[model samples]
Target: MSQRQRLWQRLTEAGIAPGCHQALLDTGRLQPNTLKLSHWVQAETALWLDGQLLPSVPPRRYWAYHKPVGIDCNVRPDDPQSIAALLQQLPPGVFAVGRLDKDSCGLLLLSNDGPFAQRLLHPTQQHQKTYRVDVDKTVTETMLQQLRLGMRYQAGASWIEARPCLATLSAPNQLELTLTEGKNRQIRYMCKQLGLKVTLLQRTHIGQLYLPALSAGQLLELQPQQVILAAQQP
Candidate 1:
């Protein structure tokens, strides 16, 4: 499909009117920033008001939220401290791809389209995510060795994917890890079994994308191709 066609499909999937997509094409003003492609698509998606279709306005789009520690990823109905509180300052319908545990913080992708979010977060794709972790004690050779061979841990049930890799060891107690799976507290559980207590865990990369220098609570819009790159990753 042509770029315009793909844009149309995304817009339709996002609940934007077909005419609105055409209108955007007619105006020819869509240009995505470097943040990633999903943001580009979300920005181009048409907005709706009441029952009338709004003209293709550069939709308020994808944001790479540098989520700080201690915030829920989901929009809550009553929690004022949730990420939802921060996002509510923007337009409605914005949602997160995957999730960050309240205590875990790092790069998070948020968008307005449900389908676009699904393509990135779906586990079957096995998109690789890199994280920087800080444990309470120094990492040992034996613990590192065990992590190389996939270790099973109980998290409601026994689970294992591939063993995680040590990306970069900043200090005796600080290290970086990369894994393809995003099971609930997967890294923390793995560390616990090996006599490590996690002090901090922040995801820094997902697929070909990185968080760059975006600060806590700050957000950047993604270019359309960036989103496509992740979607096409194995």
Candidate 2:
């Protein structure tokens, strides 16, 4: 068979989830759709989610946004301060790839592809996301080491351990950390556990997709390949 097809066969046989590759295909990173089976997997409806043909799916789109603090990442209609409202306008079905709590801000990716979102946000992917944080107390190497070694915290009714991540001190009160998975308000909670108060929490990168110098509340439309492929990278 084709080299690409053979590669897929080998990857699957090697125990990697085929869903990961298919998600990339559905996201449009596998361009020209050589397999022609791409996108069809998740399509609904003239929609040949490759060959089915009922109703065609909408063209995929991605965005890099610098969310200002206080703006919720949710899309609840009643929540006027949600990111959707902040955009003033947006195409149908567009949403944040992952959430950044209202109290935090930074590089947030938005997209219309569900599979892409699921794949990127899935904790198993362990895609590196970087953040810059400011705290109330002076930073220390000990704190950085502790953060890098991981933390155990409540998960539902049980306690669970977090995956280790990379951390470094940038200033007396500032830290740069890279995490593969994100729990809700994890940085803030973890810092509090270490006797520090988080003052600023800003995401600066998602995989290889770094935030351009956009001021808070600004965004730029882009192709999924520009960033979707990044989550698949080292």
Candidate 3:
């Protein structure tokens, strides 16, 4: 095996998937982006196969999971219910992109490919993630308008922009909010700033990936088209 293939084998053993390696290579190519047949893994493929290398995955795989409220996004080597524990039986190397606190539930994306995961999680991509929040108090039109207008907040002696939250569902005491920035406990913090409390939180979408009809704790592999669309962004 070539040195590159040898390194790739080690990566797989270390829980990195092949598709991610392909993504890195794709990113390094010049314009008129075209992947040659040699890009495909072959028994005789050399380390210098492309004359240039990148950390990537060929056809990145994406998964949509219905995460339950009780499970943490992290793997607990000891907890069988953690996302990692659950994936152990299906395949190796899959990992969650962004995180959802243990108390929140809804759609989540996972992949064995590292480059794809990096793009989705990177701050520059600005991929919008939406959530459905149920709060303890009724919302006022003025409050909704404020949320929509980007409220100001104090973050330890510094001011920060609070992006507008688009409401998708509403009840006297419950609401679904769409957010762009994935700040830690941002929805809860925003509601608290407005004198409201969150009774429940669920993230329903990530870019074009939706929670769909999957019940909590179930996972579905993303279709090829879905992956392409997600990468392009709307």
Provide the RMSD of all predictions against the true structure, rounded to 1 decimal: 9.0, 9.5, 8.4
Each candidate's lDDT (Cα)?
0.68, 0.71, 0.68
Q: TM-score winner among the candidates?
A: 2
Which candidate ranks first by lDDT, i.e. highest? Answer: 2
Q: List runs of model 2 lying over 4 Å from the truth.
A: 1-55, 86-88, 154-160, 223-225
**RMSD over all Cα atoms, model 2:** 9.5
Q: Pairs clashing in candidate 1? A: 36-222, 36-223, 37-223, 37-224, 37-226, 37-227
Give candidate 3's error at residue 38 in angstroms. 25
Candidate 1's residue-wise lDDT over 83-154, tens digit each?
868766756556677888989999988876555665667667567788889999988867776776667776
Candidate 3 lDDT, 181-208, residue by residue in tens: 7887778777877888888899877876
Instruction: By TM-score, rank the candidates, best first.
Output: 2, 3, 1
Model 2: lDDT equals 0.71
Model 1's alpha-carbon lDDT is 0.68
- Give the TM-score (vs. native) of candidate 3: 0.71
TM-score of each: 0.70, 0.74, 0.71
